[model samples]
Target: MATASHPHEHRTDGLVVTSWFAPGRINLIGEHTDYNDGFVLPFALAVGCTATVSQAAQDWSVRSAQEPEPVVVRRSGLAGADAVPEWTRYVLGALWLLTDRGIDVPPLEVTVDSDVPTGAGLSSSAALVCSVVRAVGDHLGLDLDDDAVFALTRDVENDAVGAPTGGMDQLVSLRGEAGHVLLCDMRSHDTRPVPLDLAGHGLSVLVADTRAPHKHSDGEYGARRRGCEEAARILGVPALRDVSGEGLADALGRLDDDELRRYVRHVVTEDERVLAVARLLDEGRLPDIGQALTASHRSMRDDFRITVPEVDTAVDALLSAGALGARMTGGGFGGCVIGLLPEGDVEAAGDAVRRAFADAGFGEPSLFTASAEAGARRV
Candidate 1:
C-alpha cells in the first residue's frame, strides 16, 4: 500500500496532490446477470478516471470541472449523509466506508480528471470510487485485499450513495487483468481468466458512447432488481442462477404478470449467453461470440427495457457496417454500444455509427477501441 506524504513533501498552493488511476470496465458478456448471482465476463478499458489527492489540512475537499462550491466535505464530519448529492457522495462514501472498516487514513484535497465518459455505462462512478479507495488505502497502508476493497466500494455505492448497483463494476476495477477477460461468478466471488485474443481473428471492439445519461437514482433500475428477487422468491431459489435457461419456459408459465415474465426471460437468457461466450473464448473462437453479444443487446432492449433509441441505433449502425455483432454495454437506458468488427472494418464501423447518430439528431458519439487492461494499482 502506498500513502501520501506530509504537506512538506509537495508544494501546494492550498492543494495537496497525490495522483491515482482507475480504469473503466466493459462487460464482454453477461448483461444484467450480476444481481442474479450469475456469471459475468468483463475487462478493464484503456480509458479510465484519474484523481489527485492532497491533505486539505482541515478536511476533504473535491474540485471538478462540472461542480461548484468545490464540493467540500469534512473528514470527521459528514452532514446530510442521506441527502448527499451524486458526484460528491462517491468520494465521501469511500472515505466513510474505509473508516468504518478500520482504515485510519487522512483525507485532504482532491481533484479528478477522467476519460471515462460519465453516464456512458463505462463504469465511470466505479472508476472514481475505486480510485478514491485505492488512494486512501495506499495512504493508510491497510493492505486490504481486493475483495475487501471491492466490498467497501460496493457498500459505499449501494448503502451510502443509495444506488442499487451490482458488484460487477467494483470487482472488475479491482481484479482485472491486461489482455484477459474475467469470467466472474458474483455469488461465489470467483474469477476465471480467459485470454482476449480477438486481434488474431482480425476483429476489434469499437465502443460508441450514446451520451445518454443513466441516473441510477431512478426507480427503474431498482425495480428491475426487485423483479429478479421476486422471481427468485416465487421459484423458491436463492437467485436466478438456480434457474436454468431450459427451465425458464416453465418459470415463465408460473408468472402471471407480463412484466415479470419479461424480466425473468432476460435474466435467464442472459446468464446462458454469458456461459456460451465464455466457452467460445475458451475454445479460441472469437468470431462466434458475436451472436451471443447481439442476442444480449436484443434481450436488454426488448425484455429488460434498458435500451434507449441511442443505444439501439448505435448497435444497428455497427451491424449495418459489417460488424459481426453489436450490443449496448453497461446498465443500459443509454451509455455505449460495443461492436465486434473485422480489423479492416474498424474505421468504417466507427464512421457508420457516427453517421447514424447524426442522422438521428443525436450528438456526435465518441468512438474508441478498447483492450483489456490491468485493474487498480499504484502507478
Candidate 2:
C-alpha cells in the first residue's frame, strides 16, 4: 500500500484538503459469484474516483458537483439508507461502517470527481466508496490494515447503503497493484497477485460505457443474491462455494424449479471460470484466459440475467470486430462492456462498436483504454 503525508501536514485557509484516488475495477471473470462466497478475478483500472476531503468543524458534510444540495450527517449521527441519497450513500455508509468497527473519527467534508462513468459497471460506486473511506481513515489517524479498510467499505455498501454487494470491489480498490490483477478469494479474503502482461500480447483493454446506469437499491441485484443464498441453504452448505458444478447439478436435480437450477448453474460455473483464469495467469497463458472471459459473460447474461440488451449488443459488436473477448464488467443491468483486443486494433474495434450502436439507435458511447493501475492512495 502507498502512504502519504498526513492530511494535517498540508492545510489551506483553515481547511486541509486531502485528495485520494480509488481505482475502478473490472472483473476478468466470476460475475455475480462474489456474494456467493465464490471466486472473482478483478483488476483495478486506471480510471477511477478522485476525492478531495477536508475536516468539517460542525458535522460530516458532503458536496458533489454532480448533485444540487450538500448532504450533511453528524459524526455521531451518520446517515442511513433512508436519510441519504443514493449518490451520497457511499461516503455515509463508509463512515457508518468504520464507526461500527470502532474507528472513532470526526466529521468531514468531501467533494468528488471521477473519470469512471457512473452506471457503466466499471465500479464507479466502489471507487467513490473506497476513496472516502481511505480519506477518512487518513484524517482520523487510523492505522487500519488493508483488510480492515476493505471490510469497512464492504460493510458500508452491503449494510448501511443497503446494496447486496460482494467484497471484490473494495478488496481490489484497496489492494490492487499497478500492472497486476488481484485474484481475490471472497470466502477467505486471501488475495493472489497475478501479473497482467497485456503488453506482451500487444493487447489493450477498452471499456465502452453504455450510459445506462444501474442502482443496486432497486432490489434486482439483491434478489439475485437472495436466490444464491437460498441455493446454499438448500445444498446444506455455508455458501455456493461449497457446491461444485456437479454438486450443484445434483442439488438442483432435487429442486423442481427451473429458475433455481439456472441460478445454481451460473454460480457454480462462474466459480470454475474464475479458478481457471487464475490458473491460466499463473502459467503465463494469457491467450487462453480470453475463453474464460467470454464464457463468464455468457453465464452472466443467460443465467444471472444481469446483462441488458444494450450491454449484450456492445459485447457482440466488439467480439465481431476482432476483440479476443468482451463482457459486461459491473453489477450488470446497464454499464460498460470491456473488450480485450490487439493494441493496433483498439481504435478500429471501438469505431466498429460505435457504428453498431448508432445503427441500433443507442446513444453514442464513451470508449477508453484502462491501465492496470494502483489502488487507493492519497494523491
Candidate 3:
C-alpha cells in the first residue's frame, strides 16, 4: 500500500470533503487466468479515478463528472437491487458492502472524477470502488490493511455489483508500485514487484484503446468463466492452474468437448507464458520477453477465441511497424492492445495502427504510453 498523508480538505456548503485516489490497471500478460487460479503480470496506470467524499445532511448522494445526473438514495434503498445509474452503482456498492459487514456507514455525498476510460478493459470499475472505499475508511479512521481492502473492494464488485470478476484488478490496483510490474499468484494470493525500467531498456509500451467498450454484464465474459470451471471439474483438478505444463497434453486429451479442450489449453499455456515473462524480467532481459507476449496473444486469439477483429488488426499493424511484441490487453472481445517498441519506433507504431484501422474501416483508436505507478492512497 502507498503511504497515506494528512488528507487535505475544503468546505463545500459547510461540509468538509476529502479525496482518495486509486489507479486502473493493464495486464501485461495472462488474461482470463485470474479466476482459474493462474498467474498474471499487471501494472497500475498513472490514470485513475478520485472520489471526493463529504458527510451528507440527509440521504447519500453521488455524482460523477462523466455522468450527467446525480444519484440520491437512502441507506435502506442501497440493497444492490435499486434502480441506480449504472456508473453510480460502483460507489453505492462499496457503501452497501461496508454496511452489510456490520460497519456503521454514515451517509455521505461522493463526487467522482476520473481519467480512466470506462469499459476499455482497464479496470475503471475497480478504481471507482477502491477510491471510494479508501475515502470511507479514512473518513471513519478504520485500520484496514491492503488485504482487507482487497477483499472489501473485490466483494463489492462481485457480490454487490454483480460483476463476477476475479481478485487481480482490485489487488493490483491497491498494491502496484512505481518502476515495477506486479507478478500475481492467484492460488497463494501472493505478489512480487518485478523491475520494469522501460526507458532504461530503450523500450516503451504503447497502449491503443480500440474504443469498443467491453462490458462485464454482456454474458460473454460470464460464459467463458463457466466454461473454465466445467473444464477443471472434468479434469479432476481444483482449477485449470493445477494442470502442469507437462500434464497439459494429457489433460486436454481427457476432455471430450473441443471447447473445453481449447479453454484448458489457453489457461495452462498462458500461465506458463506469465512465468516465462517473469523469469526474463528477473534476469534483466526485458527485450527477450517479446516472443512470449506475442505467443500469449496468439493463444487468446485461437484457443480462448476472445479477440475481435479490431484488436487483431491492431496487433498485426503494431508488429508490422517494428514493435518488438504486440498483444491485446485486458479481458477479451473488445479493449486495448499494448505494443512493446523501441523508443524511436513508437510514433511509427501508432501511425501504422491508425492507418490499418482506417483502411479496415474500424474506429480510430486512442493511443497512450504507460509506466508503473503508485497504488491507492489518500491525496
Please give each candidate's TM-score: 0.92, 0.93, 0.96
Best-fitting candidate, measured by TM-score? 3
Clashes in each model (backbone N, CA, C under 3 Å)? 6, 2, 0
Give lDDT for model 3: 0.88
- How many residue pairs clash in model 1? 6
Clashing pairs in 1: 2-138, 3-139, 16-54, 18-53, 56-108, 306-333
Candidate 3 to truth, TM: 0.96
Best by lDDT: 3
**Residue 137 C-alpha lDDT in model 1:** 62
State the local distance difference test value for candidate 1.
0.83
TM-score of 1: 0.92
Write model 1 residue lDDT over 105-202, tens digit each, in one string: 47567677677788888898899888887766655556678778888889878977888888998888888999889999989888878888977887
Give the Cα error of residue 189 in candidate 2, in Å. 1.0
lDDT of each: 0.83, 0.82, 0.88
How are the candidates ranked when ordered by lDDT, highest leading?
Answer: 3, 1, 2
Model 1 root-mean-square deviation: 2.8
lDDT of 2 by residue, 1-379 (tens): 1223653335778566677889888877778888888888889988888777777787778888677898887665344557767788887777776666666657678888777777777788889999888877776667778878888888878877777788889899888998888888898999988987899868888888888789766789888888888877877889888888767668888667777778888889889988888888788887777777888789889888899878899999999999888888888899888888889989999999899899999999888888788889888
